[model samples]
Target: MSSLNIATRALTTNMAALQVIGHNIANVNTEGYSRQTVQLQNAGYQSTGGGYFGKGVEIATVDRAYNAHLTREARITASTAAGDAARLERLEQLEALFPMGDKGLGSALNDMLNAWADLSASPSNSTARSVVISRADAFAARLRDTAGQIDLLRNSTQQQVGEHVDAINRLATELAGVNRSIIETAGGSHVPNDLFDQRDKLLADLSQYAQISVVPGEGGSANVFLGGSQPLVLGTQTGKLAVQRDPLDTSRINVMFTQGALATPLDANTLGSGALAGTLRFLNDDLSAIQNQVGRIALATSSLINQQHQLGVDLAGNMGGNFFVPTGPAQGLPAPTNASAATAAATVSNPQALIASDYELRVEATGFSVRRLSDGTTTALATLPAEIDGLSFSIGAGPAAVGDSFRIRPYEGAARNLQVAIAAPSSLAVASPVLVTPGTGNSAGMSVESLYARAPSANLTDPVTLTFNADGTFSATGLGPGNPPPDNPGPPASYNYTPGQPLQFNGWSLTLRGTPTAGDSFAIGAAPSSAIAQNAGNANGMLALRSLATFEGTALSDGYVSLFSDVGSRVQNAQFSAAFSSNVATTAEQARANVAGVNLDEEAARLLQFQQAYQASAKFLQIAQSTFDSLLQTVGR
Candidate 1:
């Protein structure tokens, strides 16, 4: 090649290099901008007699400093970190509701128990009885308030899920547009570095909402997938995601893809990592479990208290009524598509045997089946009145169709409905129905350890007297006589008196302790009527409630403590997970930056190098022009 052509080629290549260096330096702080370098190559040589002549340098192409694997790793780690952080924030809020120490549900339960103990001491004191009722009301109020807060959290999470889904759809659509622009601008010859940067930024934003996988498509376009397989963007055509209400649970929100004719619900477990996944996790697992636990405590408390209260007689000489109104079961009937009119209802049979779970009752071809949602345990249903896990289910009217089903939430809203049933202090059951007393003129000392009326409705018009005989046998009078007492027969049957054994007769039991002389006698009689003032001081039944075993064999107070501890532990675990995830994301981001990030110092050095090369190329052009001028002068001479 000639000197002029060589100098021109050198000048052009140097100018392009300077422009690339300037671009890199200008975009040093731009987010998602990768550093770019100019490629140089030797121009074609000309054939000569001795050897091929050398040529000056020419510009080859401009390349971006990007690592696809590193970028993908950063995106994955960012998605995980975002999910963990979101979950941790919500769990922290939930944990704050159930504060430990004296201010929480544990203290409220203790206050209720203490009130009951004080009422047992002075059963006739109207103030003490009122305190008991007040404490119970406080306990129920606390439970209801806590449950309401949990529901609020769940609702907030559902709302956030919907918002995130909208954001994901928006970003996906914008990313597809960017992909189309990049393909058209680049035209397959060179990479559009700015457009590529814009695409990367959009992907990073989208990953925060949902896990995404990106693949290079034809003509500089990209195809993005959600949760690894679901297509979100395919070569300039985008798909949308939506949030919809769950059919079985109207309160629950389900994430779905609306790409096809029919929307398809996405499995929560299949969602790899994102804010949407975290929100669903809290709603379906953590919040649901907490609500069930609160409901379980409510059911156990009401059932046990009502049962014990019924076994005693109030100051009015009447059997104790229910202490609390039990919560009814929650039912979700089948969709209107089912032809059967058969409906199912569930009632609590044994509160102590109840589990914190929801049940699905399905009518199969052969029989009905009840499945526990928590553990997936399926039990076959028998006749109409079928019982399982303490719940008695009854089907109504006609035979159920094969596809007919019902969801039974035995304790879903129990806490919200828990309340004090009794309004009058005089109605508190704190006395035994039958009273036992020692007869006058008895020598040996014998005391009644316990006394209970076996049949509250049985008429006990006359008192029954037990006289100890010389042969250690006891004879009863006032009750009907004979081994099997006949109607209206006088006197009672005789029997051996065993120390510390309960003597049962005439629908009543009297437990006596200590040895008695032959002349010692005990009398058992009915409690006085409501008009009698002495009945107010009796607290035998109230004292017995102090050691009552309720709430799955544990004290009610202990159950609340366990629930508080569980919430605290979950919060701690969530905090740790969030921190660990953040660290992983930071490391992955640093690695990606090492390959694609622009360093101002490196760009500055390249800028100086390119400037000197441009100056040298200009000098070469000047020397070639001067030589040509001198050669022209000589030719003129």
Candidate 2:
């Protein structure tokens, strides 16, 4: 190569370098733009049968200043960090809506328990009863509100899914256009570095919406598939994606391909670790679970409260009314009609009338014969039998006239798979009564005193005892042998089977019956006589509050107060955990951005270096041109 030709090659190389440097400076602030540099090589000098050397530099190629491994790492980092942030933000919103402490369900449940206790303390106070109703109402309201908030989140997530789908489609279309341009520009030895950067940015965006697998295409484009199936993009032809409402949940959106008639449900379980995954999880899993937990709390609380309230004595000294009703499953609402309530009352008079009206009376003849259930002995009686083991029967003193019926159930072997039916519609015959001689001996055929004497020996400090005092009053304590004496000891008494009067105990009535003797003890029986005993002494309020607050009381004391504390603690803990997760995610995302963010200062420095090198090369080319021109002129002379 001659000096003039070498100078020409050097000038072209310097000019190309300058152009590359200028392009980098122009796109320094542009998103996803990678810097470029011009590579140079020495042009060889030719000599006839002599050593050859390079005269001047020639432009080899314009290359992108990017490391493939580092670029991939950056993309993966952005995808995961963005996904985490999105999930945490949604969870935080739900957590905030389900407030903890006194303001939340915990406090309302506590108020309900206290209301019950107040009602029990003053049974005649209608105000107390009203408070109970109000507190229960508050509990229900709070639960419903919390559920509504969760639903709102679900609906919002659906909208987000739609927006994300739109974003993904747009990015995919742009990527395809970039692919076409790159393939066309790369027809010869030249490569479009700027277009490659744009393509990388779109791929990073794609990863946020779905767990994508990228395949290198014929040109610079990538073939993208989601979750190992379903093509998201195909070279220069991008696949269309859309969001549709989920059939099962209108508040949620499902992902689908535009070409396909079939739809795929997009849920948290299906799409993992991306923006769509986070939103889907919030809708189908996180929000739904919280709502379910709230529902359970509401259901359990209502059921227990209603049950115990019915069993206890009310202000009028009558059995209290139902407080809460189970709104799910077993007792979902309007109580099932009882057989007794469905039948008409009997209308007969006198001894013969009792027998004649038996056919018309709605008598549930259980057909249970008397048996020493402990020993399995059967004996017939005019009255309904009480000593049967698995059999229970009730009789109507047959006063039935017309439009009356009887139901009968006979005990089967061990189990009571007995059947019942209306035996009569108008009247029916009553069984003949058998008379027996009265005796001074115990009617139970066993000493009644023995029943009271056999209290449990365990927990001796609380010795169980029975007391009978003047004016026919009575008392019993749940104490053992070593327990302390009764606090108000002088009350071994009975009721006036009381004329124009009612017995009172702890601000409530105690209606007693029959006579009592010092040594001739009438048994109080194993069961308590209090109306509250209808609840089986289980203290239903504790259960009510526990369920209301979603509090498990494995470590709590056996009382309503313990239940309240446990529920409050759990709610507070959940709120704290949610807040902490959100804060941590936010911090981590910021850190990730700092590490991978585009830096204008660094890009500028690169620009200046490449520019200066290009300028120096141009000057060298000019100096070589002048020297070559002088030599040529001298040779011509």
Candidate 3:
């Protein structure tokens, strides 16, 4: 009876080992399935008077071949790779928008400047004037088109963020349900290895969306966290991730993690690493920064050109108006969470001083603090209407709370609505309004040098005459309405004369060289239709803009190149990071697979070994049975 019992136990244990080997072979290709091994040990020993007799083998417990460290490393590296790849995808698109050669914003601007150069050569050519106007229109169209395409890209990116958030929420809920199932099925002595595999697999999938932390909980349940200590899954419950728009700037959105009634918004740079984190980072940082750069160019182009255009006279001999309409500063808006009625207003005070960045204006105990979002730098302001980066901020209305905040975007949408306000070729300001004429009857060989207007005033165009007296002195007539108002509203009593000297009058400058006759007289005044046909002074100003270090200490063309290179560099860096992280992730995953991944050949070898054991146990059982039968027959005999 004892021999039979031992054979029976041996046969059952070997058979169980064979079954485990077969199960491993069946799921050889299953993802996240850890290879299982059968555990076996001696059933027991029965002690008698003579000695102890060893019993057959018995199954102990099925164990999984898994290493937690390798698995965790794999997930971490995968999350990093996902984030870099996603950011690189968006940056490549941005790079294409700001091109290097032809079809670029810089190219359009160059062509426009060339048009002005042509007008300078032929100031009275109607066709040349029309070409300048046409080039202006074309440049404006390109600006608007580029801005529109960027807007579309931004919209697409924002939509993807929403989709990623939805996917994360769904994954969280599914994982929570799986956790509940784990709790229910884990209450037995025999562990549910399959359920453990499922839980691990779900966790790996969830890690693709956001960086997370997994903690072992009771009865095989896991508590998952995200956004640093914010629980996404607490045992059997799930939290939600959502997108919320900035009340100050609706164009921007924020991501939040909500559990029960508690919710918190994530900082732009603190999401760790994942596909969702990458998408949000790109949407909030990359998109806004590049758009601000493009808008900065647009604002500078309009502001500089229009200012010069207003100082000149058009083909019709009328003072030139704005050639391109100025764009927005996108006034600051108080945050919705603020508890104050105080408001802040912003304006583009000096376009040349502007940089492409968003700012945060927070009311402080002392006064206020302006934070530059680009580099996380803050500037304190103890007064209102202060200028920073070309944006002037002033208080408007009542004040209350010290912690009130407002967002100020000086160049967000400035490029979107840029347009050429000049509709006719005749509106091109190629002529300087002020003109200086040398004395026709001079005998001292006096010659006029360059003459141009420096500014404008109510009486800037008023006519003035200078008469060289016999005492080597000059008297000015009809000069009261211009520069240096005449004493008693009449011409200056007298003025000393010097050869090769510049005379400033009536918002204009006149330079003369060579000796002047005592009776010599010169006339200077606003250009009439007669002078407008031959004047190309203001066109020269436009040509000078090509070499002006007006855009952040670089020429307008060089500035665009700088921006393009900056974006390209970002894309290149992201590509390198993505590839490196992906390689690391692959290494980690392989390391994990070496331990827990099912191997068909290994399983086959174990299957054969277990098969032989089972056969041996069966033969032993057969021998035991035969002996028993033979003993019974002998007793009967």
Q: Estimate TM-scores for all models.
A: 0.84, 0.60, 0.85
Steric collisions counted per model: 0, 28, 0
Better of 1 and 2 by TM-score: 1
Q: After superposition, how far is residue 316 of candidate 2 from its true place, in Å?
A: 5.9
lDDT of 2 by residue, 1-637 (tens): 2655665776677677767767766776677677677787877666656677557778888887666666665555555555555666677676676555678666776676666555434433446545655665676666666656666677777788788788888888888888887777765776777678788888878877766777888666678877446677787886777777644234446677664565454444545556876666666555544543454344444444444344433322344444543232110011122333332211111111111000111223443233332224445535442322222334443342322233221111001111111122111101001111122432332222101111113241232233444544445544224433444544432223232233322211222334544322322223323332222121223332343322343211122243334334544654564456456545654454454444567656766775676676667667877887888899999
In candidate 2, stretches whose alpha carbon ends up further than 4 angstroms from where it belongs are 48-55, 249-253, 266-270, 312-637
lDDT (0 to 1) per candidate? 0.78, 0.49, 0.81
Residue lDDT tens for model 1, 1-637:
2888888888888889888888888888888888889988889898889899878788788989899889999988999999888888889899888876777887887787677666555667889888988988998899889888888888888888889988998988899999889878765667788788889989998888778888888666788988558888998888888888877666567888878676878988778788888878877878887788888888877776676677667767777888887666555566556678888878878766777887888887778898898889999865657888777888887888887888777777888788889899888876766777787878756777766543333544358888886666677777743323332222334576677776767656577888778878888776666523344223443343334454556655577876777788888898998899999999999999999988888888888898898888889889999999999999999
Q: Which candidate gets the maximum lDDT versus the true structure?
A: 3
- The deviation in Å at residue 382 for candidate 1 is 2.1
Q: Write the per-residue lDDT of candidate 3 for residues 135-163, one digit (tens) a residue.
A: 88888888889889999998898898889
For every candidate structure, what is the RMSD over all alpha carbons to the true structure, in angstroms? 5.6, 17.3, 5.6
lDDT of 2: 0.49
Error of 2 at 487 (Å): 28
Candidate number with the higher lDDT (1 or 2): 1
Whole-structure CA lDDT of model 1: 0.78
Q: Which stretches in model 3 have alpha-carbon errors above 4 Å?
A: 48-50, 185-187, 338-342, 363-369, 397-403, 436-525, 631-637
Superposition TM-score, candidate 1 onto the true structure:
0.84
